[model samples]
Target: MEEPQGFFSTGDGCVGDTVTERCLVESKEPVSHVQLACGLCFCAFPLDGNELCVWSTKDPSYQPLILRGHRQPITAVTFGNTVSPLLICSASQDYVMLWSLDECRQKVLLASPLLSLLVDEKSKQLVAGCADGQLWVFSLVERHHYRCVTRVDLKKKRETFSRRVESRLCSLPEENRRPRAHGLEKGEDMEGSLPVLSLAPCDLSLLLSSECGCLPSESAPCLWVGSSAGLLILNLANFELEGVLRYKDFRSLSIQVAGSCAMMSKAGEQKAICLLTSMFGCQIAVLEIRLAALMRSRQDLGAGRSLSVLPRGCVLSTSPLHFRIAEEHRTPPAPQRRTVQDQPLVFHSKVRSSGYATAPHVTMFSPKTNTRNNGDSPSRRRSSHRWCVTNLHFSYSFYAGDGRWLACGLANHLSLVFRADLTGTPAVFSGHDGAVSTVCWSHDGRWLLSASLDGTPRVWSLRRAELVLCVGRDLFPKPIQSAQFYYLDAFILCSSGPELQLLKCHIDTSKDEIRRYKQKSRCRPVFRLPTAGPTEITSLSAVNDFYSYLVLTAGRDKTVEVFDLNAGRSAAVIAEAHSRPVHQICQNKGSSFTTQQYQVYNLFATTATGDGIKLWDLRTLRCERRFEGHPNHGYPCGIAFSPCGRYVASGAEDRHAYVYELGSSTFSHRLAGHTDTVAGVAFSPSAPQLATTTLDGKLQLFVAE
Candidate 1:
């Protein structure tokens, strides 16, 4: 069978009978788990009517086998050995069913609510671990049906019935027999509490039991069981305990034998592999068992000793993320496109500790963005308390004139609104269909410019609380990366993906209409600067000297290119600006230095990681000096030079924000307050106050102390 390759496609089923609709597939329910065995792929999901559905790996068409014996949900399933008469076993709350894949019939092997199922060492028998703290052994030799021939009481087997003239605890050395106060006591009964969580087959269990008199001369394979107490290797032959791998605080939730994936040396000696999932955390430990160490060990097996097996590696589950540069949401020609009012998402603040300063707590409040009101901060008047009025990003945040209003673009396709005091407000702008990448403010602070991955650029008027204009995809085929309004909003200079475009807009404040137009008036690009750039520009900053201006764009390739709008060509390119990807570039928001009369621009560039900030002289087309001391993080640091151009502040991934003296380029004191990454930091335009935005959606304020 061929492995399914390429990226997984997602969409609704097609309608037409044409060739383009042939590959469209649909599912009524979501798949819970996927399994592959003997070159056949199986997807398992609980059916609507107390049934379990198993579907095969065929695209555009599906065939499922309905298994309906269990009254409860099916918790686990596994395939049988590679021998003749293939079998599949399922474990649920009611009983364990052993079914023949060829015959399509099954019989209850045991009347036990099982948690895990596995084939024994010889592959001729099955080992079922139940929630009743018992191990049931069943033989698959019968032609008609398998029967549970024996059962092992896990608690009794762990009691350590010694063959020699010595008590189990007294048999160990004086130092090794020390009592453990945390674990279970000798008389404590854990009968109903200790449920079998995970199970596997191991040969080492048999080898260890052979040395101790606990070995039984029976004919069954060995089974490894994992419980809340620790890991135990059981000799299924005579229902005796063999070996143990102990971990006190963590309980095992799932187990898998990586024996097939074991690494071997030139001498043909193979390493044993085991993967165990923790019940409390999303951590999976990969332990490499050495049979040599177990065979030649001195620890007494009579008094259950902890096997010194450390994890060779670990597998941590990562949060899944979905983002796009821009999604083309084309409006159908007339009478189709409609207005969409997005549902309000509960806004939260201060999810983590305040590291540096303690501000007044914004008791419990409902907000569209992460903004919460505290003390006497004003609140918006929204009739529906269940839904917030204004709503909710990263370095995507920008301050509008004197920092009266603040906007943050986020990955959730929403922008947050906050006042200069970092308090709650109801004036949030939301219409983007994709992740908001960058936001800019008009110099006068009246208009707000925002570009998103949805290939749409919108202009918002703060005074009017309305969406002024939207630059449609008809004028922008690619997503806009970064956008900045020229001096007074004459032409919006935008990083139109790999190139640049000067989109023109008219200030029509006279029309204060509360409506979404299906088809807005289309405007063409007045100026275009095309550079078949190697990568999409992630950061853009435009500096207009009151005439034919210049825009600097930082690409993923770690190169910065200066585009002269007058010449309509690339002026200067700065290579190796940083060791890693530069995500932010800030030109002095105030003006160039008066000392350098000929120079027009001085910019601060920050990379995703590596050394600190880099200052560039656009006149010389080279780096002046790098500002070190601040640590780099994954998210682009919210970097900004103070209005006076005396200091610079940038957010850090480590829940801290860094301050630097622009002249000395040395590290200053850090604003330490926040539990998560400080995503955006900006200095107040009017005062000496600093504002910070965190990933958890809180806007923090700090005074220069």
Candidate 2:
């Protein structure tokens, strides 16, 4: 046989295809460095040793490319004026390089060390501190060239003197010009009017030096010097002493002045000098020149008058060399909330229905209505009642007439019946040698049917709580998997090893004997339905009506088969409907009907290998939809549809009961009070309540909103 078009070959035969294909491309390089930036601390790492990798904080695994370079380890990164084009300056200890990165590629420019670096619109400058303690001025000379200019030398001397004394009489004081015996005057106006200082290289007139450690200005005619004893402000234009600032026991390391003093420049402005000890301690001292004194000085020099400096403002001390201040602000506006208005509402019913009527001797309105409403007010009752039954692991359960009684089948071949009247203790009926697999109540509420792994079906009287009859292997000569009562005639569908046998049931109430209503010789095989490859039938449920009479069966084939019960033969099949062998099949209440209007109905639902619940439409013989959000590790063992047809509850091997909404077609929520795999789920007929039993032998009741 040619393989199905979309199916892939597997060890377990053909299955439906659901995976999508994808491809990935990788670069041929190794990653080197990683860094995180921004005020929010987002992570940015290097990929391929050349590309910048960026990823969100929440998801660090998926790294996307932000920028790629031709060379590796783009060092010296800085965020420029714009957030983009984060300026990255890299040097290989041999070549100095500059790169402007936008998003993907790094643009390399200015690959030389002699070039000066320009401060962009971001107001940040790069000052080179050489090993000789000399500062180099770097500014943009052109669009691409940065001119480097060497500024000052601290080793240069201002004046030199010879050690020869000219004359001892010349050191005499001016007040006493007459020479004394020792040739020394008492009051001395000696030291012959301080010697003039001159530059060594006269051609380098632009070069300036200070007596103490002072800063040379680019546009000022005065150089300010600072030493351990005092501060010296000297006129560069006239080579004269201008002003002296005194401080005790402190030395200055750096001086920053506002403007010139000799020339008509912006003077009288606040000048700041940063003082530092040899031990790397710093202090800031400020000097403000009076505007009146500055104006008079300019007038004395025969220069045009102008307000060189504004009035002094508040002076600050001990400011850092590179200081940054940030103002605290409020958080940004929240994003507009997005509402998922069209998402379907999932209605979940608890394991048992609350407000179930507890009246005795109540009758159902009609066989077709399936309504058992009593005159009791729904608000007057507690949602559910708690019961204590030890080791009561139930695999199947049914609620009879007006929710007055409940029957449960257990894996230990024990059956339990709980009276809703809450007046008496529950009764246990045990007879089968193997696990009881199914239980159901007759329409008239007189007989209860139970099928077991012991290959027998038993009938019990509800009032006496006693086993009435046992239909064993002698009747069908095979393992009976499921049995149900249909009004006067009981419909028993059995799995005889691998074949399906349908038998009609009859009860001789006078002798209290139950037997196969049809003669053994006349009873023939109705139809032999297909299994899940080689798996046997595991479960079955019969619909309530005639024409479209359906028998839903689950098998180890991972498929749920819907047989045409009235056709007397299994003709159509839904193959491979589940990912694995299905454990149970259940018909929704009110799903079985014969009507003139052709209404579509989701007849039955099944639970299988995966944590998935599938809905089957009987009329089309197709699997309509699936609910897939259950715990993936669990094996779904039993399923039950709520009487309201709005929700489906399932029990799994993970010891949890999962409730799924039929309208939303999704698993809504999970109930986690069970200690072992939940084996059965049954809802109250009159209200939204549920009863659940687990393999650990605990029974629980739950209410739904």
Candidate 3:
């Protein structure tokens, strides 16, 4: 038996076809808790309480990786450091389990009566934070038993130190040490005399203890603690209190230090990585504490600095604190440095405000031939101070001829026209009962046409600031989906229900009557335009000459159809126009021209779907190219061609407006800062300025570079 041929096709000849490509621009980084290794691909395992799922960087889909066996929700998971990679540590409530990745077998590493557990690099040590505000460090041995090696008992440790100091002072000779020394316990000597307490048996020499509220650094095992008075650093090696770093009023929640150095292969070398945190947004501090630096500081304390060093061939630096020494006796160490790692992974509980300064707006010039600097000497300048209109709620906006006036259609069924000079009150025209879906002004700037969800189309006289006439339901009795008016002929093409209708308006003062000349419907309402099943009409736009052509309509059926008014028939049908529903379509007047000999006129502009924006040429009914720099996988909500035909600006559901240079087919700049979806984008007819409206009830004006 022969296998059936696949239904999918490739290449350029057919309409309603599909094409796929990898995206080049990246959106916001995905939120994840644990990352997995897969060669060059970085995958994140996202946990939502009980489920364990993995998502890769190359693909958007996520799948379940592990399930069952975990009595409580897994807090964290990490792979082993070795190439053989047998162990995978899973931290859960009160315990951490070491599981063999190949066999899927598990063994309890450290069982602490705590809420959370964290395993160190070797999986030989585990750190657990308990409900009693204490941290427990546990060690595992080959005998299959866990031992508590160190316990940071924060409860009443200060009180116990006070009593011990009092007893020691009483035994001192009266001539050598005065009784007044008892008050010194409240200061410096309090930390130095505290004894190091061992919680369990371990061969390692280091044992550090301090107050409850602090975290350990990556390089040094020195735990930084914050008390009611100031910051304290405890040396983990000898359990001695180190020097204080900083003093502050509020107790520190977290602290990080940063620096930079060349890579080295040997231990006791200087290295640094910049550290940032939620506590301080952009301020970075240098963390300069080499093994040599620690050893020198120890010698300065008269602790006998000549400690036994590790063998030359030893790769792992066992004690991070012992490598530091004074610079005078140093041989500059070896050129080999520890491999620099990525930034430490930390979970911040508080939101941090951005620290980036606002950039001053600058201006440049764009001539017909080439772009050039506008002034005598090109220099950046701050934009003019203007009041931001915060009360306006507009879904879309457009400028009239020469940008003398800006017209915006709001969700409240009001069309407002503001003077470009920003001097007078904006003219308000309200006629529709529902939201105004679309609004546009005539080419001559005499009339404005608006379509609303109220199932009517209204024409407003700009000079009078009043509705002159209403179309749709009064004549066709169907809801007007979209409408556009021609300034020269006073002809209007409106999409009503499933049909495109043409209407001509006339006014007679003597008869005191408004006359409407209705032409035949260009496209018949066949199949109800497939309201469902991927065939609903999404957008409609008109070309330059209304007498020759009436409208262009795009639908979810992946087709663009041109309606011819003169011939009273569908002029051309461009099938398979987009991958998804085309939400917006606009005609480029400058590109829509043909010579007598060529017999080809192309309308160059943009159409949008859920994927991205595509530049289309109407003559061949083919997509010439695509603009692919939207940061999010957003549905394009609005698009417009610059008056000079040099740029195309598009708005998306991602709350950003992207401007693309038409000649070079590259992105010009991104206009962000919108708090909600950008519903519409428009360019000024006179100046190098653009306007956008968002769902957050705000209007923003941008000047081009």
Candidate 4:
């Protein structure tokens, strides 16, 4: 079998010659499995061979390192979950071997034929799932000793429960004549179990189709075990099975590989969690998991002390199996070279329109005012009118995921969507009775969500330029401070008063009032996350990546709270983040233009009134860098990371935007075009375009020269 070559897409929205194949690794014998470790190296094992080959992709000239220890063919291999990618575990029938690449040492553990392995670095635990329905848990003592914690027999546990339920039902008196359901087997004592095929640590970042944030913390950790029967979710807190999920249509599914990704739903622009499952490399299927409903049901089951399995209602909505055909290898296409800008960036002097531009060139001042003095000429009057549209400043602004559009929330109770270059006519979304505070674009860039002081969070269809869904203001306790699309737009996250609410909603644009009302009724709150402080939340930020589940929020009490959406709990807190309430928080959404390491995406920045911006690493929970010199006293002075993640751009009270290099503390560039305090800044995801909104209702557009 030939190994597939690795390729990276340029993401330039081109169909031909967009993907470029980098390198190809070859083996003398056919490789059985290959796994990449830390995005630096990979290990490949051949079938019917007792040795595995490890190659460092960083050095192309280096030869593959052969590691031999297993007496039998390796069944499974996994890299250790640690800060340093030095340890790896290989499983076989003889024993499970843990190898340290740095020291070239191995620790062997006598165990059964393990099919799957999971290493928990934080908890110092390792779980091995065998061909039989047995889960062996081990404790890693001081990174060397491996002591058996407990052995869980999933098959026996299910059998025991089924037998007890069957005996109780049989003891009851038989009913007279009853309508019977199809496939109802009489006296069926047990639900059959399947062998464990694969295992992955339960991570909200991994399960929710987001993988951009930090690793899973040690609190309430869980594991996802895939088998032919169903996917089993086991709570590592007590090493007990918490929930079992089976597809709605399929009775038996051989889930060899199971993962989640963001995909469009059949109903309009709503996003859904697509569960991709592979069966023994022969069959593939894509199923949809209603994450909000499933999570709600999980909580109800826990409250009722029924942890055997998830209800059928929580089962995924089944879809037809999809088969993928392998394409033959062909000659590589010529790569396209893009022209680089001559200068780094250039800012425009004239004020650019942001919101609700009805008349293209309307005269705001009267003819008498323009003729009064030479300073108040027609040019000056036109510039002044453009600078203060609707007499309302922008409250927030964000660039769309693809960098093609920009969304801005204004104080005049309106939301605006503009082209990145501010060339096309702005798409105005109205209806809010108060100032629009939060503006967020959907991952697909088809929808825009805005939250206002009126307490309503409205979803607007960008294509139709209409409101598709809106929540009542009476439903919330206080005004909404922040709102955005979370979990691939599967849930709407907003902060109201001191509570953070997660809502799962469906977008219905039906003309029928009754049908629209029914669809609106289907929108429900999955959970609420409250701040640790007594006061309300001041700011919040979360990455838009599909595999990120970490939501970072700031409190009025001068603290930063990190919530793990996967576990639905506060994972960590950074107290006294600033002397005053934190005003803004921004995460480094890695860019396609630059090749960043896996850990770079975990970095974030926070700023507060009168305080300088501080960069933090989510993994270490420590401040890595402090950027000062920019005067930010009253306004929030929103900050944003450049597309390449190498620079940070922030608004300032000095009537300018400051750009700082990540390695240095001093400001690198001072953008001095704004006439008032800069309110917010946004960087284009696809290009070197920077947009700044000022307190004087002026929008400035900058592009690479």
Candidate 5:
């Protein structure tokens, strides 16, 4: 008998290593606690057998390094964020132990039970929140000089700040007095203080300067401490409370988790930060605070001056404390249920429904020029040679303004234009030297625009299937991600890396070889709008519906920003729109070329990996609904709204297209046809037709019977 060529050899000892590695992860005891460090580099857990297992998250198949020293039940285990010599810290009833993975050495510190632990790499400090309403700061400046720097009694600070605030309020007139401030309960001063639950650092480097009118130094980081009563901002340098933020509406909230994220500012001199707090009672609050106000509060709390309240105007806006729950929608009874694959995708074109063969030549209005010399020559279609699908690439495709044509960008340095029904031969436009990434059509359906990774954008004359204008490579510093006809085709809009340019282009199809390189010089940038934080734009969307002025862009930093072209500035920003980078965004551009109501433009949808498609109202800047049921974790699947705006469609990793009613969270139809991950989806504006493309270079079309 012959051995299989791909089979592993047991004589090489591979089978024994595999068995040993598999058994190492198996334990008779269950894991009681688990904790993961900040970048998810390391994970630590305490087994029920009183043993601590520290494992590398990057490679979990290997045997975990185990440490056994704690005698009492481990209350908490944390991993430090240091790059080298992974630091593992654990707390017990007696003390806290720090284990260095590199040296295999252990250091012990006497302390009380800790609820939360944070290791600050910049300051070389270990900060812990104790169960006794206190904060312990340990300095690790040197191996031998490690010692407790200071301990803050949170309960004492809260009481003293409360009394100082009450005394100041007592001096006001009776009519001016309102409900007890800070959401404090009646006779709360007589009760005990709230226990500290969490601690996080607030880096002042996110802002330009500190409150004392000087740049933020390396040692001037702030600490945000969360407790049952409220949240307190403390100056880590002196361990003094700077400001307190309490929700007046939710007096019973016990804040357990606190976090912060920086916001992009229009002006480089000032920025803002959003402080987020989650309480035990299913309540969460998001407060946007300006850096100027925050630094001013720090100045007001100097050694000689004392103010316990947050500085006025520091908080730009505060969302009401509430929990977000996906609305469950009950599907209504229908006349008849239809399967998703009821209609089959027919391949109407014989030549892969893509490009033609010959290249068009340009001359200075010469009568000897042959009219059939364009790439759409009929003789080439009958030849033995044909365009290979192996080199073709499809990034995006869309329906024409009149719904009669479909344009698709290809990686083979060409774009294909065909009928919407996938019938008839596609008109091929070839000029780009790199893969074409984006395709846009003029509102009148006379001209088409395309962009490619070759760092140039070209305009094609649809009637002649010839390139009229092309931009130069030197104009853009990076490859163009997207380009389209904006403002009724009066100007061109393109996003190249982190910058968006609005250009006034003059179309010149004069193919005189002498002026061939002059087309790029005809276009000049009118506005250069860079995204906040200089984040690279992943997706761009703008409707040419009667020259709409709003341009929306999604950045790699998980932010959706709307630029007001009329105002020449960023109008609004939706920060942290999703947990990951937003890859697809679509506005409800109806099939009709006429401008519809403003509400139609206001409703847009955004999709990120793993996160479901979110419907947002531009006017309110809030998520109106979330449509899920499709798995899109590994790929940046495309999303689009139906022409009527009644339904939304998305491609998923499960090789199917999901269609959901706008008012419902559950999927209404699961269209199955593709064999690979569906990466792009588009709905026809003129008819009830849908098109989907897969990652493996396959296109499918579905039409309502």
Candidate 6:
């Protein structure tokens, strides 16, 4: 298998990137580079007969916002700055126009046949390139109205002098108008309008989305204009010419882009601009510019710390470059182009207004006003305490404080399924793209943390019914096998990377625009735990009870690491703690009467090794005993302990839960009900009951007699 760009394979040939398609939008035309913001995607393309069109990203199989208004084929399209609301501007031969996101309406701006479009977030200015060899920068006083800062005619001096052509100045129309013949006929149209060959708007404030800068700076915004004649860079600050680098010797190699240009940001530190020119068939030309020097030149504007600097001196190249599109992307069928005749002033469509409904994917389901079989499958049973709610299977479940809230780990997301006291369906929290590996709830039941193979742990608020924070890969670029809150506050300990990591995190509520409380981040990661190797840490368990301030972790390395907060770092290390990869860990308070004395001990168990659950004394950091009745078929199946610490509970791959009396070290009951491997087992803090989640999506509650 081939690795993606920017990724490297390990000595074992394991690369970090996973190949998966999140969504697909098949169109009858070639799709431009897509930009996404505020849960929406915007793309522009020329459809049947080069009809310029704009489509908003839609849910799978959902009808997209087919925005139409451009009179001629589009040259460039881009979205507004991230801090600003959703605003899309497009430039074409028809003139410059602004399209409101979601609403299907368009407002005509300058009537000049514009070539490119860009919005400077700092000054709130709209900049465009014209086909008549002129540059126009419009200060957006409000909307639709633009007062031009300046305009420059870009016709070369040699061309003007050689032909003795008296260059006529282009007009900036005060009102909306389209060029046509003087004589009016029923079917007459304008064929003189042509697209500006090349235009690209590179914003300076886009660095806000990357967070590489500590502070926001004025992006001394500029436009890179390219034509068959040469390349010219214009300053948007005063609409002045900054520099012009042309290929006088290689004249035949410079036919500019007839469509839009693309940016490759992740492939290299330098922001490389890739454009497909009309001069060569399937040939791509890449231009890499140093924005730091440009920013330093305009440092008065928002320019953060110096970014990357390309060592190259030349800005223009004549060598043919090929940008390979993946094989999965087929060459869009080129439809027959209709003659540019009988052009109408106003473009009509099925849409009357630009208003569009929100995509259906952002849906939420709360508890019911009238309750049913609770959190169980509908066909399972109808008891009050035990209900059948769904046919969908779950891999893990946990009963929060007093057994009021039951959270189950689903596919990439998880569910906060309440007990029978509450109504409605469960609240599903989604973000991760990998299967949820482990889940833990905070002591007060306000915060719920779920770890996944997606290399991050998502923080979900049970009170808000929404996902609050995502501990991203930046904190540690390793799959989070398990994660837990240190207490109710403080930081979090996640089992990832070489061993474990401490992430500085916090959450709080803020007033929204209308003064309603909304959860937001107070801080992010402050530092990371340092380790030596690249081996994966797969399991984590920490004691938050009054019993102790200790943490236990194990994984593929077959070693158990215990971290004592009060004493600092691993208090002890048990070598060869498991024969195989450790899967799960459960920390509980256990009391044993030994030698005519009642002794309370800090104990934890690991579902590792070919043997069953192995119980260890945390105080001594030694294995107390191994319980081996349950079938050890899967990697470290789930293990749990009762709140009172009287009984030890665990689930095996054979779909059986083995409960043993800790004092006797003997099996007490063999619970068999699930159709598949029992992924997790949890005991209620207040009630004498056990909850089990299976791979077949079953959530069952078992009560102790």
Q: Tell me the lDDT of model 6 at 429.
A: 72
RMSD list, candidates in order: 25.4, 39.7, 32.2, 26.5, 22.3, 30.9
Each model's lDDT comes to 0.53, 0.43, 0.45, 0.59, 0.60, 0.49
Tens-digit lDDT track for model 3 on 1-705? 011123212344343546453222221334345443342322223244443332224432211134335566666766565323334566668567665442331111122234445554333455554433345555553332454544454433443333434544554578644343332345544322221111111111121111111122212234433332222333332223333322221134234321111111122223222122223344433233333332222222222121111112322233211122234653323323122223322112231211111121222222122324344232222112232221121112223224467777777777777654333456778878977766776655666778887877777777767666676465545556666764233456666555665665542212223533432222212112222233446567764322223357776576677654433456556554555666667765421111111111234454655445666544334344455545323434677876445567777666778776543223445677777777677666545556776766655666544
Q: Taking the candidates one at a time, how many backbone clashes does each contain? A: 10, 14, 15, 7, 0, 22
Q: Would you estimate the TM-scores of all the predictions? A: 0.44, 0.42, 0.44, 0.45, 0.50, 0.42
**Model 6 lDDT tens row, 1-705:** 011122211232233455433324444544354322233555554443224344435422122344566666566666765312356676666676675552342122234466666675655666676665655555564422564533445653222222211111112243522332122223434223223456665454443223322223522455666665444455444233343434342345443433444333232243535454544456656656555433332222212222111111221122111112245554322222112233321112422211111111111111122435545766434323332221121212233223466666666354445552333355667777877766666655677777777777877777767777776676666777777776324567776677576666766655577655454664355334433335567677664322234566775677776654433445555655665777666766321110110122356677774545677654334344556546554334577776545567777776777776554333556677677766677665554456776666666666543
Judge candidate 3 at residue 321 and give its lDDT.
11
lDDT of 5: 0.60
Per-residue lDDT tens digits for candidate 5, residues 535-573, read 999888887744455788999999898876655678667
lDDT of 2 by residue, 97-138 (tens): 454443222111111122112232211112332222122333
Superior by lDDT: candidate 3 or candidate 4: 4
Q: Specify the highest-TM-score model's number.
A: 5
Number of the top lDDT candidate: 5
Model 5 stretches with alpha carbons more than 4 Å out: 1-402, 510-521, 593-597
**Where is model 2 poorest over a 10-residue stretch in terms of lDDT?**
157-166
Candidate 5 residue 366 C-alpha distance from true site, Å: 50
Model 6 misplaced stretches (Cα beyond 4 Å) = 1-401, 420-424, 514-519, 530-534, 546-549, 566-568, 589-601
List candidate 1 stretches off by more than 4 Å: 1-401, 512-522, 544-548, 591-601
Cα error, candidate 2, residue 478 (Å):
4.1
